[model samples]
Each structure stands twice: as structure tokens, then as C-alpha cells.
Target: MKTIAINGSPRKGWNTHILVEEALKGAASKGSDTELVNLYDLNFKGCISCFECKRRGGKSFGRCAAGDDLKPVLDRIHTCDALIIGSPIYISEVTAAVRALFERLTFQYITYSKDRKTFFTRRVPTALIYTMNISEPAIESMGYAEKFKFYEDRFNQIIGPAKTLVSTETWQTTDYSKYEMTMFDGEARKKRREEIFPQDKRKAFELGAGLV
Candidate 1:
């Protein structure tokens, strides 16, 4: 099996990278070939909404018309067995770079009939990983949960439902002394770090390994 993991985080070796790396490691251990693509390192433009793809009909038909870095990535995605996308939430939404990548990737697959309804019947299996500073409950309370659902529905429309994994408030500690007493409870934070994050990371890894 071959799996492709897309890291949408701007930082190269940070939280998103670590999660994707762990997932890829899991896939590799299972004898699956895996590739990781960092969007920040690529040169890609957002979709132009030119509707040229729908007009054409071939392997290139479903590809973005814009000549940018996303074209090759799109081609790779078409051939991969399983896809994992990881992004950091910013301002209650996906980062601009990641959002643009999604736009370019998904917009070309849409087809509309006389009824003016868009449909994407050709689909693939995909997984979504979102890392944010806010806790899951707080994110939900702030209406950020819908952002994931929106992406889920969009991906489902083109590629089936994605199994989403979320990592909340993952930040490295620089100075422990500066934090408040309640916040600086080292034991509690350590427990969460060593226990919870590893479990989540392992889950992501297993998901990659199980890809068909």
C-alpha cells in the first residue's frame, strides 16, 4: 500500500510535522510506502475559478488549470492509496495556505448539470489532522467545530468522509518560571504530554498503517 501525507503547517519541524512523521512511521512499519508533502515548501496558487477543468475531459480534466506548485501534488494525490492532511487552525479556520491548497484541489473536481447543483462522484479515502492551541471543547464552543465539518463534507462530496484527528493546545514550553502556579503544575502537564499526546500520535500512525 502507498500513503501520502500532506503537512499543511507552515512550520517545518513543529507539531504538525511531528504528527505526520509519526503517522508515516506507522505506515512504514506496516510495510507501506509513504510520502510526505510540506505545503510551505511548495509554490502553489489558489484556484482561479476559471471552470476550465469541467470543460475538458481526460486525466488532466480534473486538474487545476492554474500552472502552479499544486499541479504536481494534485497528480500525486490522484494516484495515492490513502491521503492524510494535517493543518493548524488559525483564527477559527484553516491556515490560508492550506485553504488555498484545498480550493485548488477540490474545485476542479466539481461538475454541475442544468439544475446548477455540483456533484463529485469520483472519490478517494482521506484522513484529516487538525492541530490547534485551543482545547477541543473550547473550539467547539467557539464555533470552530463547524470548520472541520465543512471540510469533512467537502471532502466527502469528492472523496468520501475523512477520519479526523485533532490535537489541541500543543505548544513547547520555553520558560516554566513565567507561568502562573496553576498553569505551571509540571506533573499534570507532563502526564498529558507523555500520555495523551503519544496516544493520539499513535492513533494517527495506526490510521496510516491501516490504509487500503
Candidate 2:
């Protein structure tokens, strides 16, 4: 099995990236060849709506036509056995990079014809992981759950079987005093990091292994 993971967080060793790495480890433990992609390391644009992928009998039909850094990653995903995407919540939504990837990755396979709904050749297991500073209860109150479910539903429709994993109340930094932020208690955050984050990592691992 070939599993591909996309890390949509800008910080390489932070919560989002850490969870993504854990997921990849789980995939590897299952004897799957795994690759982890850092989205921020590459420069790319969202779907430009060129319609080339939709043209009847076009060379790029059923594929994203954008020629950029993400093209190769998308090409690999087209034939991969499983997929895992991880991102941190920014401004109550997924980061800008992840949003752009969503447009490029999902929109290409979407079809307007009544005869067909997606262009993906085969069904594969997929998972979406999100790390956020908000508490678990706040997810529903803030409508984040709905937004996440929307993405999951879309992935189920167009991509394959998809699951979502959320890590909340994430520790932001090792030293909070350096920043101007005072809304959070550093000790509490640190405590959660030490106690709860490992549980999240385990869940991510299980999610990845199950995907394979």
C-alpha cells in the first residue's frame, strides 16, 4: 500500500505537523510505503477555473491542469492507496494553504454532468486531521464541527471513505510569555500537552493504520 499525507500547517514541528507525522508512522507500521508532504514548503496556487479538466476528450480531463508545485503531489494522490490531510485551524477555518489545496484537489474530480458525480478512478480510504486551540465543546458552538463535517461529506462523495480527527486546545508554544497573548494559561496548556496530546497522537496513528 502507498499512503500519502499532506501537512497543511506552516510550522514544521508544531501540533499539526506532529500529528501528521504520527499518522504517517502508523501507516508505515502497517507495512505501507508512506510519504509526507509539507504544503508550506512548496509554492502553488488554487484552482484557476480554466475548465481544461472538464473539456470533453481533453488531454487533462479528470485531472487538475494547474502546472505548479502541487501538480506532482496531486499526480501521486491520483494513484495512491490512501490519503491523510492534516491542518491547523486558523481564524476559525483551515489555513489558507489547506484551503487552496482543497480547491485544487477536490474540484478537479467534481463533475457537473448528471451521468457522473466524480472522476476518481477508484475508491480509497482517507482521513482529515485538524489541530486547534479551542476546547472540544467550543467546536460545536463555533460551528467548526459543521464546517469539518462538510469537508468530510464532500470527501466521502468524491474521494472515498473518509474520517476526521480533531485535536483541540493545542499548546501553542513552549514559552508563552514571549508573546503578547494572555488569554491562555501556560501551565494548563502545558499540562494538557503532556497529558492529552499523546492520546491525540495515538488516535492519529490508529486513523492512519486503519486507512491502510
Candidate 3:
């Protein structure tokens, strides 16, 4: 089975990367072939809103028309059995790179039938991992959690139910001297790392192992 993980964090080895790596490790333990793509390392542009992909009688139907880094990645996403995406929240939404990837990838799958209605028909099982500095309560208060739900529903409607993994109230601004105090929530994070996350990771691994 094949699984593809997309790391959307600009920081290569930071929180988002750690979570994706752990999930991938679990997947590998189940004897699934896994690959990771770091978006910041690739050269890609945001979707240009060109109607070329949806043009009638066009050869690029069901594919992105723009020639950019997203083309190859989209190819993998289309064929991969399981997809894992990790991103650090910027403001109340995902990072720009991830958002751009979504825009470009989603456009490729947009289609219409004889009725002239648009819809997404291609199905891909997916998981979304988002880490942020805001606490869960704060996220709800700020309406970010609801925004996440919007994305979740959209993904489920377009691709499939995307298992959501969120790490909130993370330590982003760290100082060496008062590190212990700053990591007051370290124990909780550790528990999640050692327990909750591993379970999901194993599940993801099994999902990959069972894929065709």
C-alpha cells in the first residue's frame, strides 16, 4: 500500500513535521510504503483561476492545466491510497502554501455534467493535522474551530472524510531561560504524543496497508 504525506510547515523539523513523521512512522511499522513532500521545498504557484482545465474537449480535463510543482504532487495524490496533510495555522486558517495546494488540487477535480451543475467526483481518503498556538477554547472563541469544520465538511464532500488531528496551544515563542515554565502544557502534549497520536497513527498505517 502507498501513503503520501504532505508537510505544509515552513519549518522542516518543527511541530507539524513531528506529528506527520510520527504518523508516517506508524504507517511504516505496518509495512506500508510511505512518502513525504515538504511544500516549502518545492517550487509552486497558487491556482491561477484559469478555465483551461474545465474547457470542453480539452485534453487536460480532470487535471491541472498550469505547469507548476503542483502537477506532479497532484498526480501522486490522485493515485495514493491514503493522504496525510500537516500544517501550522496562520491567523485562523491553514498556511498559505497549504491553502494554495488545496486550491490548485481541487480545481483539477472540479467537474460538471449535462445538467450544468458543478461537483467533485473523484474520491481520495485523507487526514488533516493542524497545530496552533491558540488553545482549544480560544480557537472556538475565535471561530477558528468552526472554520476547521468548514474545511472538514468540504473535504468530506469533495474527497472523503478527513480525520482531523489538532494540537492546540502549542509553544511557539520559546525562551531558553524559562523554558520549563513556558512548557506548562508539556505533560499534556507528551501524553498525546505517547498515547492518542500513536493510535491515530496506527490507524492511518492500517488504512494504508489495506489500500489497493
Candidate 4:
């Protein structure tokens, strides 16, 4: 078995990265070859509407054709068993990297012809992890969860339903005192980091193993 994780967070060791790493560990423990991809390290763009993937029986049919650093990744994805994508919410939506990756990954595989078939005939277990500055209660209040769920449903429609990991009210910096950020209660955020984050990692590990 092979499982790969892509993290769209710019920070190397931040919340989203940590969660994805945890999940990868789980997949590895289950005897799967696991890899962690940091999207920031890659240079790529979203689908350019080339429609090359729409060409019937062509080399690009039912696959991404964007030629860049992400192409090799897509090639691997075509044969991989499990996929995990995680990102920090930027203004209530996925980061540019994750959004671009999604556009390329999903649009290419989506066949618009009659029957609306997806490229993947077999269900590929997947995971979606999110890191945000908001709290759990505020997520539904802001309707952000629905937006995330829409993409989850999109993933399911293409491949399969994804297990999700959410880290909320994240600590943005090592020292909150350095910045002029009075909106958040530092103590509560620290409490979450100390108490809840460990459990979240454990959950991520379990999610990964289950996917395998």
C-alpha cells in the first residue's frame, strides 16, 4: 500500500503540517509507504482550461495535463492508494496552493460526458485537514464548515469520502506577545495547544491507519 500526504501550509511545522505528519505516521505504521509533500515547495498553477483531459482516448484523457512541478505528483497520484491534503484556511477558504492543487486534481479527472464518470474506478481513501484561527462554535456560525464540506463532497464524488482533521484557534506565532493581536485569548489558545492538540494528532493517526 502507498499513501501520500500534501500539506499546503506555508509554515513547515505549523498546525496543518503537524496534523498531516501525524496522519502519515499512521499510514506508515500500517505498512504503507508514506510520503509527505509540502505544496509550498512546489511551483505549479491551477488548470488552465486546456481541455486536453477531455480528449477521448488521448494521453491526457481523464488526467491532469498541467506541465510543472506538480505533474510528477499527479502521475504518482494516478497510482497511489491513499491521498491526504491539508491546508490552512485563508480568508475562510483553502489556501492558494491547495485550491490550485484541487483544481488540477479534480477538473482533470472529471469526465463531463454522459454518465459523468470520474477517472478513479476504485475508491481511493483520502483525508482533508484544516487549520484555522477560529473556534469550533464559530466554524458553523461562519458557515465555513459547509464550505469545507463542499470540497469534501467533491472529493467523494470523484474518489471517495475523506476523513477530516480540524485544528482550530491555532497559535499563529511562537510568541503572541510580539504582535498586536488582542482579539484572541492567549491563555485559551495555549490551553488548546497543550491539551487538545495531542488528542487531535492521535485522531489523525487513527484516521490515517483506517484509510490504509
Candidate 5:
């Protein structure tokens, strides 16, 4: 089996990347060859409303016609057994790169007919991971949980059975004093990173293995 993990965060060694890597490791341990993709490394845009994928009898029907770096990634996902996507919360939403990938990946398979919902041939297990500076208790109050549910519901309907893993109060920087972010205590963040992040990683690993 092949499982593909996509990292939506720009920072390679940060929380989102680390968790995605851990998930891949878990899939690897299950004897599934896995790949990790960094969305920032590619140059692409969100769906341009070309509607070529929806065209009947068209050569590019049921596929994204946009030619760019994201094309190959979408091609790989079409054949993968499982998928894992991780991103850091930016402005209370996923990063722009992740959003672009999401649109291109999901919109292609979507159909307008009432007879069929998607053109995808098979169901692929999926996971969504999110890391944020806010505490766990704040997720609902901040409407993040509602947003996450919306994404998960879409993935479930269009892709496959989906689950989510969240890491809260993420450590943003080694030296927070360098930035003007005075709202957070750097030491407390460091303590939580040391104490809680490992547990998060373990959960990510299990989540991946379960996908297999």
C-alpha cells in the first residue's frame, strides 16, 4: 500500500512537518511505502473555475487541467491508498498553499450531477492534522472546531473515512524574544512543547498506522 503525507506548513522542522513525518513513519512501520509532500515547494493556484473537469466527453474530464507543480502530486494522490495532510493554523485557517492544494485535489473529482457525487473510483483513508498556538480549550470557542468539522465532512463525503489530530499551544520559535509577540510566554510554550508534543507525535503515529 502507498500512503502520501502532505505538509502544508512552510517550516520544514516545525510542528506540522514533524507530525506529518511521524505519521509517515507510522505508515512505513505498517509496511506501506510512504511519501511526504511539502506544498510550499510547489508553485500552484487554487481552482480557476475552468470547469474542464466537469465537461462531458472532454479529454480532461474528471481531472484538473491546470498544468503546474501540483499536477504530479494530484496524480500520485489519485493512486495512493491513504492520505495525510498537516498544516499550522494561519489566521484561523489553513495556509494559502494548503487551501490551493485542497481545491485542486478535491474539486477535480467532484461532479455536478445528482446521480453521482464524485468521480473517484475508490475510497482512500484520510487524516487531517492541525497545529496552533492556541490552547486546546480555545478550539471550540474560537470556531476552529466548527471549521475543522466542515473540512472533515467534505473529505469524508468526497474522499473517504477521515480523522483529525490536533496539536495546541505549539512552540513557534526557539527564541520568541526576537519577535514582537508579547502575548505568549516563551518559557511556558517551551515547557508544553517538551511535555506535550511528544504525546501528540505518538497520536500522529497511531493515526497513520490506523490508516493502513
Candidate 6:
């Protein structure tokens, strides 16, 4: 079995990356070949509106025709057994690189046939790892989780169920002493990091292994 993980964070060693790697570890432990792809390290663009993938009765059907770095990843995903995607919430949604990859990759599998109600026909099991600055309690009040829920639901509609592991109140900076914020409590942040982060990592690991 082959499982692929994508890191959407620009920083390779950040919380999102750590969680993705943990997921990969769990998948590897399950005797699956795992690969972690960092989108920040790749040069690619989102769907270019070429409409090549959407054309019917053509060679481009069910495939993204974009000739960029993303094409290779999408090609691999077309045949992979499992997929894990990790992203940090930036301005209330996934980062640009991830969104770009999502569009390019998902749009290819989108189907509008009369017999098909869902977007995609692929049956791959997927897991989403999201890291955010807010706590779980604030998710509903701010309605910030709705966007992610939409994506998750859409993924389920397209492929199989899309499981998500969310880490809140993430460690944002390497050195908190270098920044200034009166409202910030460094001790609480450290406390959460020490107390809760490991559990989240374990959750991610389980998410990966379970899919395999």
C-alpha cells in the first residue's frame, strides 16, 4: 500500500509539519510506503481554467492537464491508496499552496454526468490535519470551523470519508521572546504545548494508521 502526505505549511519544521510527519510515521508503521510532500518547496499554480479536465469524451477526462509541478503529485494521487493533507489556518482557511494544490487536484476528478451526483468517483481514504491559533471552544462562536467542514464534507462526497485532526492554540513562533504581545501568555502557551501537543500527535498517528 502507498500513502502520501502533503504539508501545506511554508515552514517545514512547524506544528503542521510535525503532525504530518507523525501521521506518516503511523502509516509507515502499518507497513505502507509513505511519502511526505512539502508544497512550499514546489513551484506550482492552481487550476488555470484550462477546462481540459472537464471536457467530455476526450483524452483529458478525469485528469488535470496542467503542465506544472502539481501535475506529478496529482498523477501519483490518482493511484495512491491513502492521502494525508496537513495545513495551517491562514486568514481563516488553508494556506495558498494547499488550496492551490487542492483545486488543481480535485477539479480533475470532478464529474458532472447525469448519473453522477458527486464531484469525484475516486474511493481513496483521506485524512486532514489542521493547526490553528484558536481553541476548540472558539470554533463554533467564530463559525471558523464551517469552512473546513465544507471541505471535509466535499471530500467525503468526492472520495471516501475525510477524517480530520485539529490542533488548536499551536506554537506559532520559534522564539516568543522575540515578539511583543501584551495579551499573550507565554506560560499558558508552553503549558498547552507540553500538555496537549503530544496527544494531538498521537491522534494524527492513529488517523494515518487506521486508514491503512
lDDT of 1 by residue, 59-135 (tens): 45655777787888887887777788889888778888889988887887677767644434545678888888676
Model 3 agreement with the true structure over 130-212: per-residue lDDT tens digits? 88876667877888878888877777866776777777756453343456565456666666556655565555445434332
Flag regions of model 5 displaced more than 4 Å: none
| Per-residue lDDT of model 5, residues 17-54, tens digit only | 99999999999999999999999999899999999999
Worst 10 residues of 4 by lDDT: 159-168
Taken over the whole model, the C-alpha lDDT of each candidate is: 0.77, 0.94, 0.74, 0.88, 0.95, 0.87
Higher-scoring candidate on lDDT, 4 or 5: 5
Clashing pairs in 6: none
**Candidate 6 segments exceeding 4 Å error:** 117-120
State the lDDT of candidate 2 residue by residue for 160-199, as single tens digits: 9999999999999999999987999998999999999999
Best by TM-score: 5
**Which of 1 and 4 is ahead in TM-score?**
4
Q: Looking at candidate 5, what is the lDDT of residue 29?
A: 95
- Candidate 3 residue spans exceeding 4 A from truth: 112-122, 173-212
Relative to the unseen true structure, what is the C-alpha lDDT of residue 22 in candidate 1, on a scale of 0 to 100?
A: 80
The TM-score values for the models, in the order shown, are 0.84, 0.98, 0.80, 0.96, 0.98, 0.94
Look at candidate 3 and tell me the lDDT of residue 5: 86
Model 5 poorest 10 in a row by lDDT: 112-121
Instruction: Give the range where candidate 1 is weakest over 10 consecutive residues by summed lDDT.
Output: 115-124
Q: Compute the lDDT of residue 113 as modeled in candidate 2.
A: 94
lDDT, model 3 = 0.74
Better of 2 and 3 by lDDT: 2
* 2 against 6, candidate with superior TM-score: 2
- Best-to-worst order by TM-score is 5, 2, 4, 6, 1, 3
